[model samples]
Target: MKTILKNHRRKVTVYLGRRDFVDNSSTTEPIDGVVSITYRFGREEDEVMGINFSKEMQLVCREIPLKRDVKVTEMQERLLTKLGASAYPFSIDIPDNAPCSVQLFSDHSVKQ
Candidate 1:
Protein backbone atom coordinates (compact mmCIF):
# COMPACT_ATOMS: atom_id res chain seq x y z
CA MET A 1 0.00 0.00 0.00
CA LYS A 2 1.34 3.41 -0.93
CA THR A 3 1.28 6.05 1.74
CA ILE A 4 0.71 9.77 1.19
CA LEU A 5 0.94 12.61 3.65
CA LYS A 6 -1.96 14.92 4.27
CA ASN A 7 -0.04 17.83 2.76
CA HIS A 8 0.67 16.10 -0.50
CA ARG A 9 -1.07 17.64 -3.47
CA ARG A 10 -2.40 15.62 -6.41
CA LYS A 11 -2.23 17.22 -9.81
CA VAL A 12 -4.90 16.91 -12.50
CA THR A 13 -5.88 18.45 -15.81
CA VAL A 14 -9.24 20.11 -16.42
CA TYR A 15 -10.60 20.09 -19.96
CA LEU A 16 -13.25 22.51 -21.19
CA GLY A 17 -15.56 22.06 -24.16
CA ARG A 18 -18.98 22.64 -25.67
CA ARG A 19 -21.31 20.41 -27.68
CA ASP A 20 -24.40 21.21 -29.76
CA PHE A 21 -26.76 18.24 -29.98
CA VAL A 22 -29.20 20.04 -32.27
CA ASP A 23 -26.90 20.12 -35.32
CA ASN A 24 -24.73 17.21 -34.20
CA SER A 25 -21.92 19.73 -33.99
CA SER A 26 -19.75 19.56 -30.92
CA THR A 27 -16.79 21.66 -29.85
CA THR A 28 -14.60 21.49 -26.77
CA GLU A 29 -12.31 24.19 -25.52
CA PRO A 30 -10.26 23.71 -22.41
CA ILE A 31 -11.10 26.58 -20.14
CA ASP A 32 -10.92 27.16 -16.44
CA GLY A 33 -13.27 24.66 -14.80
CA VAL A 34 -13.90 23.64 -11.23
CA VAL A 35 -12.29 20.34 -10.25
CA SER A 36 -13.19 18.26 -7.21
CA ILE A 37 -11.95 14.96 -5.89
CA THR A 38 -14.23 12.60 -3.96
CA TYR A 39 -14.13 9.13 -2.50
CA ARG A 40 -17.08 6.87 -3.41
CA PHE A 41 -17.73 3.38 -2.14
CA GLY A 42 -20.08 1.15 -0.15
CA ARG A 43 -20.06 -1.96 1.99
CA GLU A 44 -21.18 -5.27 0.50
CA GLU A 45 -23.40 -7.27 2.80
CA ASP A 46 -24.27 -10.80 1.80
CA GLU A 47 -24.67 -14.34 3.06
CA VAL A 48 -23.16 -17.11 0.95
CA MET A 49 -22.69 -20.77 1.75
CA GLY A 50 -23.57 -20.34 5.41
CA ILE A 51 -21.09 -17.47 5.65
CA ASN A 52 -22.33 -14.00 6.50
CA PHE A 53 -19.94 -11.11 6.21
CA SER A 54 -19.37 -7.70 4.66
CA LYS A 55 -16.70 -6.73 2.16
CA GLU A 56 -14.99 -3.50 1.38
CA MET A 57 -16.18 -1.90 -1.83
CA GLN A 58 -14.47 0.80 -3.80
CA LEU A 59 -15.69 2.47 -6.98
CA VAL A 60 -14.11 4.93 -9.35
CA CYS A 61 -16.22 7.62 -10.97
CA ARG A 62 -15.43 9.77 -14.01
CA GLU A 63 -14.45 13.36 -13.37
CA ILE A 64 -17.12 15.86 -14.36
CA PRO A 65 -17.03 19.59 -13.90
CA LEU A 66 -19.42 20.54 -11.12
CA LYS A 67 -19.21 24.24 -11.93
CA ARG A 68 -17.85 26.40 -14.74
CA ASP A 69 -17.45 30.14 -15.13
CA VAL A 70 -14.55 30.77 -17.48
CA LYS A 71 -15.06 32.73 -20.65
CA VAL A 72 -12.76 32.83 -23.64
CA THR A 73 -12.64 35.15 -26.63
CA GLU A 74 -13.45 33.95 -30.14
CA MET A 75 -9.81 34.13 -31.13
CA GLN A 76 -8.77 32.07 -28.15
CA GLU A 77 -11.42 29.48 -28.88
CA ARG A 78 -10.33 29.32 -32.50
CA LEU A 79 -6.74 28.80 -31.44
CA LEU A 80 -7.79 25.72 -29.50
CA THR A 81 -7.40 22.28 -31.01
CA LYS A 82 -9.83 20.91 -33.59
CA LEU A 83 -11.91 19.71 -30.67
CA GLY A 84 -12.02 23.31 -29.49
CA ALA A 85 -10.71 22.47 -26.06
CA SER A 86 -7.97 23.67 -23.77
CA ALA A 87 -6.50 21.93 -20.71
CA TYR A 88 -5.98 23.63 -17.38
CA PRO A 89 -3.75 22.07 -14.77
CA PHE A 90 -4.91 21.69 -11.16
CA SER A 91 -4.01 19.72 -8.06
CA ILE A 92 -5.78 18.44 -4.93
CA ASP A 93 -4.64 16.30 -2.07
CA ILE A 94 -6.82 13.39 -1.04
CA PRO A 95 -7.08 11.64 2.30
CA ASP A 96 -4.61 8.88 3.00
CA ASN A 97 -7.41 6.37 3.61
CA ALA A 98 -8.78 6.99 0.10
CA PRO A 99 -8.95 3.72 -1.79
CA CYS A 100 -6.83 3.33 -4.90
CA SER A 101 -8.46 2.13 -8.10
CA VAL A 102 -8.01 -1.66 -8.21
CA GLN A 103 -9.95 -4.20 -10.26
CA LEU A 104 -10.76 -7.31 -8.28
CA PHE A 105 -13.59 -9.72 -9.00
CA SER A 106 -14.53 -10.09 -5.36
CA ASP A 107 -18.03 -10.68 -6.65
CA HIS A 108 -17.62 -12.95 -9.65
CA SER A 109 -21.09 -12.16 -10.89
CA VAL A 110 -20.25 -8.52 -11.67
CA LYS A 111 -17.73 -7.52 -14.32
CA GLN A 112 -16.46 -3.98 -13.98
Candidate 2:
Protein backbone atom coordinates (compact mmCIF):
# COMPACT_ATOMS: atom_id res chain seq x y z
CA MET A 1 0.00 0.00 0.00
CA LYS A 2 1.08 3.56 -0.58
CA THR A 3 2.53 5.41 2.40
CA ILE A 4 2.17 9.11 3.17
CA LEU A 5 3.05 11.29 6.13
CA LYS A 6 0.17 12.03 8.47
CA ASN A 7 0.96 15.72 8.50
CA HIS A 8 0.86 15.88 4.73
CA ARG A 9 -2.32 17.02 2.99
CA ARG A 10 -3.68 15.44 -0.18
CA LYS A 11 -5.60 17.35 -2.81
CA VAL A 12 -8.47 16.24 -5.01
CA THR A 13 -9.47 18.65 -7.74
CA VAL A 14 -12.46 18.57 -10.12
CA TYR A 15 -12.65 20.89 -13.09
CA LEU A 16 -16.09 21.64 -14.54
CA GLY A 17 -17.39 23.56 -17.53
CA ARG A 18 -20.34 23.73 -19.92
CA ARG A 19 -19.00 21.27 -22.47
CA ASP A 20 -17.65 18.80 -19.91
CA PHE A 21 -15.94 18.70 -16.53
CA VAL A 22 -14.49 15.33 -15.75
CA ASP A 23 -11.09 13.60 -15.79
CA ASN A 24 -9.62 17.11 -15.86
CA SER A 25 -10.18 17.32 -19.62
CA SER A 26 -9.57 20.52 -21.55
CA THR A 27 -12.18 23.26 -21.33
CA THR A 28 -13.20 26.43 -23.12
CA GLU A 29 -12.48 29.94 -21.95
CA PRO A 30 -15.09 29.89 -19.20
CA ILE A 31 -15.32 27.10 -16.70
CA ASP A 32 -18.72 26.70 -15.01
CA GLY A 33 -17.17 25.94 -11.62
CA VAL A 34 -14.45 24.14 -9.74
CA VAL A 35 -14.38 21.96 -6.64
CA SER A 36 -11.42 20.75 -4.61
CA ILE A 37 -11.18 18.32 -1.69
CA THR A 38 -8.05 18.04 0.40
CA TYR A 39 -7.07 15.10 2.61
CA ARG A 40 -4.82 12.03 2.94
CA PHE A 41 -4.89 8.29 3.51
CA GLY A 42 -2.59 5.29 4.16
CA ARG A 43 -1.54 2.65 6.66
CA GLU A 44 -1.39 3.68 10.34
CA GLU A 45 2.03 2.19 10.88
CA ASP A 46 3.43 4.16 7.97
CA GLU A 47 2.63 7.43 9.66
CA VAL A 48 4.60 8.52 12.72
CA MET A 49 1.45 9.50 14.64
CA GLY A 50 -0.51 6.54 13.33
CA ILE A 51 -3.29 8.16 11.36
CA ASN A 52 -4.64 8.57 7.84
CA PHE A 53 -6.59 11.18 5.87
CA SER A 54 -8.76 11.01 2.76
CA LYS A 55 -11.40 12.95 0.83
CA GLU A 56 -13.94 11.82 -1.78
CA MET A 57 -14.95 14.47 -4.28
CA GLN A 58 -17.76 14.62 -6.79
CA LEU A 59 -16.95 15.29 -10.43
CA VAL A 60 -17.74 18.59 -12.11
CA CYS A 61 -20.92 18.97 -14.17
CA ARG A 62 -23.24 21.51 -15.84
CA GLU A 63 -25.03 22.20 -12.59
CA ILE A 64 -28.25 20.29 -12.85
CA PRO A 65 -31.04 19.55 -10.42
CA LEU A 66 -30.05 17.56 -7.35
CA LYS A 67 -32.87 15.07 -7.95
CA ARG A 68 -31.36 14.05 -11.27
CA ASP A 69 -29.46 10.84 -10.68
CA VAL A 70 -28.06 10.84 -14.19
CA LYS A 71 -26.27 14.10 -13.60
CA VAL A 72 -24.93 12.87 -10.29
CA THR A 73 -23.71 9.63 -11.90
CA GLU A 74 -21.94 11.50 -14.65
CA MET A 75 -20.19 13.70 -12.13
CA GLN A 76 -19.32 10.70 -9.99
CA GLU A 77 -17.87 8.89 -12.97
CA ARG A 78 -15.46 11.70 -13.60
CA LEU A 79 -14.42 11.78 -9.97
CA LEU A 80 -13.87 8.02 -9.96
CA THR A 81 -11.65 8.37 -13.01
CA LYS A 82 -9.42 10.70 -11.04
CA LEU A 83 -9.52 8.97 -7.67
CA GLY A 84 -10.15 5.36 -8.75
CA ALA A 85 -12.98 2.92 -7.92
CA SER A 86 -11.86 1.84 -4.46
CA ALA A 87 -10.44 5.15 -3.33
CA TYR A 88 -13.62 6.67 -1.92
CA PRO A 89 -17.16 5.42 -1.85
CA PHE A 90 -19.16 8.26 -0.28
CA SER A 91 -16.91 10.17 2.07
CA ILE A 92 -13.19 10.47 2.87
CA ASP A 93 -11.60 8.39 5.60
CA ILE A 94 -9.80 9.83 8.60
CA PRO A 95 -8.00 7.92 11.29
CA ASP A 96 -8.46 8.79 14.94
CA ASN A 97 -4.94 7.99 15.93
CA ALA A 98 -3.23 10.90 14.22
CA PRO A 99 -4.08 14.59 14.09
CA CYS A 100 -4.74 15.73 10.53
CA SER A 101 -5.88 18.89 8.84
CA VAL A 102 -7.78 19.49 5.58
CA GLN A 103 -7.84 22.71 3.62
CA LEU A 104 -10.02 23.62 0.62
CA PHE A 105 -9.35 26.35 -1.90
CA SER A 106 -11.72 28.01 -4.39
CA ASP A 107 -11.24 30.87 -6.84
CA HIS A 108 -14.85 31.99 -6.84
CA SER A 109 -15.46 34.91 -4.54
CA VAL A 110 -18.46 37.04 -3.71
CA LYS A 111 -18.41 40.84 -3.98
CA GLN A 112 -19.76 43.00 -1.24
Candidate 3:
Protein backbone atom coordinates (compact mmCIF):
# COMPACT_ATOMS: atom_id res chain seq x y z
CA MET A 1 0.00 0.00 0.00
CA LYS A 2 1.06 3.56 -0.73
CA THR A 3 0.55 6.53 1.56
CA ILE A 4 1.20 10.17 0.71
CA LEU A 5 1.73 12.98 3.17
CA LYS A 6 0.37 16.23 1.73
CA ASN A 7 1.19 18.32 4.78
CA HIS A 8 4.54 17.93 6.42
CA ARG A 9 3.40 19.28 9.81
CA ARG A 10 0.39 17.08 10.29
CA LYS A 11 -0.39 13.69 11.69
CA VAL A 12 -0.29 10.73 9.37
CA THR A 13 -1.89 7.35 9.77
CA VAL A 14 -0.09 4.18 8.74
CA TYR A 15 -1.03 0.54 8.44
CA LEU A 16 1.34 -2.39 8.68
CA GLY A 17 0.47 -5.96 7.69
CA ARG A 18 2.39 -9.16 7.27
CA ARG A 19 1.89 -12.72 6.14
CA ASP A 20 3.41 -15.71 7.89
CA PHE A 21 6.87 -16.78 6.87
CA VAL A 22 8.06 -20.37 6.96
CA ASP A 23 11.57 -21.34 7.87
CA ASN A 24 13.37 -24.63 8.37
CA SER A 25 13.96 -24.07 12.07
CA SER A 26 12.51 -25.66 15.17
CA THR A 27 11.76 -22.25 16.69
CA THR A 28 8.86 -20.19 15.35
CA GLU A 29 8.48 -16.49 16.05
CA PRO A 30 6.37 -13.59 14.95
CA ILE A 31 8.31 -10.44 14.30
CA ASP A 32 6.95 -7.18 15.60
CA GLY A 33 6.52 -4.33 13.13
CA VAL A 34 7.76 -0.85 13.88
CA VAL A 35 7.81 2.61 12.30
CA SER A 36 10.43 5.26 12.71
CA ILE A 37 11.18 8.80 11.57
CA THR A 38 14.78 9.91 11.67
CA TYR A 39 16.76 12.88 10.49
CA ARG A 40 20.46 12.95 9.67
CA PHE A 41 22.55 16.02 9.12
CA GLY A 42 26.05 16.28 7.64
CA ARG A 43 28.18 13.31 6.55
CA GLU A 44 29.35 10.89 9.19
CA GLU A 45 32.00 9.27 7.00
CA ASP A 46 33.21 12.45 5.30
CA GLU A 47 35.90 14.65 6.89
CA VAL A 48 37.19 18.12 6.17
CA MET A 49 40.68 18.90 7.54
CA GLY A 50 40.33 15.80 9.77
CA ILE A 51 37.16 17.22 11.31
CA ASN A 52 33.88 15.35 11.00
CA PHE A 53 30.43 16.68 11.67
CA SER A 54 27.36 14.52 11.98
CA LYS A 55 24.12 14.57 13.92
CA GLU A 56 21.72 11.75 14.74
CA MET A 57 18.17 12.76 15.48
CA GLN A 58 14.91 10.92 15.87
CA LEU A 59 11.44 12.40 15.85
CA VAL A 60 9.40 9.27 16.34
CA CYS A 61 10.18 5.57 16.67
CA ARG A 62 7.81 3.00 18.06
CA GLU A 63 6.08 -0.25 17.36
CA ILE A 64 2.94 -0.16 15.29
CA PRO A 65 -0.31 0.37 17.31
CA LEU A 66 1.87 0.66 20.46
CA LYS A 67 -0.09 -2.30 21.84
CA ARG A 68 0.46 -6.01 21.40
CA ASP A 69 -2.75 -6.55 19.43
CA VAL A 70 -4.21 -5.28 16.18
CA LYS A 71 -7.05 -2.81 16.52
CA VAL A 72 -8.21 -1.69 13.12
CA THR A 73 -10.96 0.69 12.13
CA GLU A 74 -13.96 -0.18 9.95
CA MET A 75 -12.37 1.18 6.81
CA GLN A 76 -9.09 -0.45 7.67
CA GLU A 77 -10.86 -3.72 8.29
CA ARG A 78 -12.45 -3.61 4.83
CA LEU A 79 -9.18 -2.74 3.21
CA LEU A 80 -7.29 -5.48 5.00
CA THR A 81 -9.98 -8.00 4.14
CA LYS A 82 -9.80 -7.06 0.48
CA LEU A 83 -6.03 -7.35 0.59
CA GLY A 84 -6.28 -10.74 2.30
CA ALA A 85 -4.10 -9.74 5.23
CA SER A 86 -4.29 -8.57 8.82
CA ALA A 87 -2.88 -5.21 9.74
CA TYR A 88 -2.07 -2.95 12.68
CA PRO A 89 -2.99 0.72 12.48
CA PHE A 90 -1.03 3.56 14.01
CA SER A 91 -0.50 7.31 13.79
CA ILE A 92 2.47 9.61 13.81
CA ASP A 93 2.15 13.32 14.47
CA ILE A 94 4.72 15.69 13.09
CA PRO A 95 5.63 18.72 15.11
CA ASP A 96 4.47 22.12 13.95
CA ASN A 97 8.01 23.36 13.27
CA ALA A 98 9.22 20.09 11.85
CA PRO A 99 11.45 20.42 8.83
CA CYS A 100 10.05 19.61 5.44
CA SER A 101 11.62 17.00 3.21
CA VAL A 102 14.70 18.30 1.43
CA GLN A 103 17.56 16.85 -0.60
CA LEU A 104 21.01 18.41 -0.87
CA PHE A 105 24.08 17.30 -2.72
CA SER A 106 27.66 18.31 -1.97
CA ASP A 107 28.85 17.28 -5.44
CA HIS A 108 28.19 20.43 -7.40
CA SER A 109 30.16 19.03 -10.36
CA VAL A 110 27.52 16.45 -11.06
CA LYS A 111 24.69 17.25 -13.48
CA GLN A 112 21.10 17.15 -12.25
Candidate 4:
Protein backbone atom coordinates (compact mmCIF):
# COMPACT_ATOMS: atom_id res chain seq x y z
CA MET A 1 0.00 0.00 0.00
CA LYS A 2 1.38 3.41 -1.02
CA THR A 3 0.81 6.15 1.44
CA ILE A 4 -0.50 9.24 -0.25
CA LEU A 5 2.05 12.01 -0.38
CA LYS A 6 0.93 15.59 -0.09
CA ASN A 7 3.42 18.19 -1.27
CA HIS A 8 6.65 16.81 0.24
CA ARG A 9 4.89 15.20 3.14
CA ARG A 10 3.43 11.73 3.44
CA LYS A 11 0.13 11.58 5.29
CA VAL A 12 -1.87 8.57 4.29
CA THR A 13 -3.68 5.80 6.15
CA VAL A 14 -4.64 2.16 5.67
CA TYR A 15 -6.25 -0.78 7.46
CA LEU A 16 -5.65 -4.51 7.75
CA GLY A 17 -7.96 -7.29 8.83
CA ARG A 18 -7.52 -8.88 12.25
CA ARG A 19 -6.68 -12.55 12.79
CA ASP A 20 -5.61 -15.16 15.35
CA PHE A 21 -2.40 -17.16 15.32
CA VAL A 22 0.68 -18.22 17.32
CA ASP A 23 4.40 -17.49 17.70
CA ASN A 24 6.55 -19.12 15.06
CA SER A 25 9.36 -16.70 14.39
CA SER A 26 11.76 -19.43 15.46
CA THR A 27 10.61 -21.71 12.66
CA THR A 28 10.48 -21.38 8.88
CA GLU A 29 6.80 -22.16 8.81
CA PRO A 30 4.78 -19.84 6.64
CA ILE A 31 2.63 -17.73 8.89
CA ASP A 32 0.37 -17.62 5.86
CA GLY A 33 -2.25 -15.03 6.56
CA VAL A 34 -2.89 -11.29 6.60
CA VAL A 35 -0.87 -8.63 8.42
CA SER A 36 -1.44 -4.97 9.19
CA ILE A 37 0.67 -1.75 9.13
CA THR A 38 0.17 1.94 9.68
CA TYR A 39 2.90 4.46 8.93
CA ARG A 40 3.09 8.11 9.89
CA PHE A 41 5.93 10.38 8.85
CA GLY A 42 6.84 13.52 10.66
CA ARG A 43 7.44 16.85 8.97
CA GLU A 44 10.91 17.38 7.57
CA GLU A 45 13.22 18.59 10.25
CA ASP A 46 15.38 21.63 9.69
CA GLU A 47 18.98 21.15 8.69
CA VAL A 48 21.46 21.31 11.51
CA MET A 49 24.94 22.64 10.91
CA GLY A 50 24.81 21.76 7.24
CA ILE A 51 23.41 18.37 8.28
CA ASN A 52 19.78 17.78 7.41
CA PHE A 53 17.94 15.61 9.92
CA SER A 54 14.94 15.37 7.62
CA LYS A 55 17.00 13.31 5.26
CA GLU A 56 18.15 11.13 8.09
CA MET A 57 15.29 9.88 10.22
CA GLN A 58 13.64 6.69 11.39
CA LEU A 59 10.17 5.48 10.37
CA VAL A 60 7.88 3.54 12.62
CA CYS A 61 5.36 1.42 10.71
CA ARG A 62 2.60 -0.06 12.82
CA GLU A 63 -0.34 -2.38 12.09
CA ILE A 64 1.29 -3.24 8.78
CA PRO A 65 -0.34 -5.98 6.73
CA LEU A 66 2.04 -8.76 5.81
CA LYS A 67 2.19 -11.12 2.90
CA ARG A 68 4.72 -13.61 1.62
CA ASP A 69 4.31 -12.00 -1.76
CA VAL A 70 5.36 -8.76 -0.20
CA LYS A 71 9.10 -8.35 0.08
CA VAL A 72 10.54 -5.36 1.88
CA THR A 73 13.90 -4.27 3.23
CA GLU A 74 16.10 -7.02 4.57
CA MET A 75 15.40 -5.73 8.04
CA GLN A 76 11.65 -5.69 7.53
CA GLU A 77 11.78 -9.08 5.90
CA ARG A 78 13.72 -10.43 8.83
CA LEU A 79 11.24 -8.94 11.24
CA LEU A 80 8.33 -10.48 9.46
CA THR A 81 10.11 -13.78 9.10
CA LYS A 82 11.04 -13.77 12.75
CA LEU A 83 7.72 -12.65 14.16
CA GLY A 84 7.04 -15.25 16.84
CA ALA A 85 3.44 -14.43 17.64
CA SER A 86 0.33 -13.22 15.85
CA ALA A 87 -2.22 -10.80 17.17
CA TYR A 88 -4.92 -8.39 16.11
CA PRO A 89 -2.32 -6.12 14.52
CA PHE A 90 1.28 -6.32 13.31
CA SER A 91 3.39 -3.36 14.26
CA ILE A 92 7.00 -2.49 13.40
CA ASP A 93 9.14 0.42 14.36
CA ILE A 94 11.70 1.19 11.71
CA PRO A 95 14.66 3.33 12.67
CA ASP A 96 15.18 4.89 9.30
CA ASN A 97 18.07 7.17 10.07
CA ALA A 98 17.98 8.21 6.44
CA PRO A 99 15.50 9.08 3.76
CA CYS A 100 12.77 6.50 4.14
CA SER A 101 11.37 4.66 1.18
CA VAL A 102 8.81 1.85 1.18
CA GLN A 103 7.46 -0.25 -1.66
CA LEU A 104 4.63 -2.76 -1.50
CA PHE A 105 4.97 -5.80 -3.73
CA SER A 106 1.80 -7.20 -5.23
CA ASP A 107 3.41 -10.47 -6.22
CA HIS A 108 5.35 -10.80 -2.95
CA SER A 109 8.85 -10.04 -4.23
CA VAL A 110 11.01 -6.97 -3.90
CA LYS A 111 11.37 -5.24 -7.22
CA GLN A 112 14.90 -5.51 -8.41
Q: Candidate 2 residues 1-112, lDDT tens each? A: 1112113233544444243223323322322222345555655453464343244343322433223133233444565466543333232222233223334433333233
For residues 3-101, what per-residue lDDT tens digits would candidate 1 score against the true structure?
A: 121111223323323221122124222222223232334542322333322344543244544323445445324333222333322223333444433
Give me the runs in candidate 1 sitting further than 4 Å from their true place. 1-85, 104-112
Instruction: List, residue by residue over 9-48, the lDDT tens digit for candidate 3.
Output: 2233233344342333443333223232333465644333
TM-score of each: 0.20, 0.20, 0.31, 0.19
Of candidate 3, the 10-residue stretch with the lowest lDDT total is 4-13
TM-score of candidate 4 versus the correct structure, residues matched by position: 0.19
In candidate 2 the C-alpha lDDT for residue 100 amounts to 30
Residue 77 in candidate 4, Cα distance off native in Å: 1.7
Question: What's the residue-level lDDT of 10 in candidate 1?
Answer: 22
lDDT for predicted candidate 1 compared with the true structure = 0.32
Position 49, candidate 2: lDDT? 47
Q: Is candidate 1 or candidate 3 better by lDDT?
A: 3
Of the candidates numbered 1 and 3, which has the greater TM-score value? 3
Q: After superposition, how far is residue 58 of candidate 1 from its true place, in Å?
A: 8.3
Best by TM-score: 3
Cα lDDT, all candidates: 0.32, 0.35, 0.40, 0.34
Clash number for each model: 10, 1, 0, 14
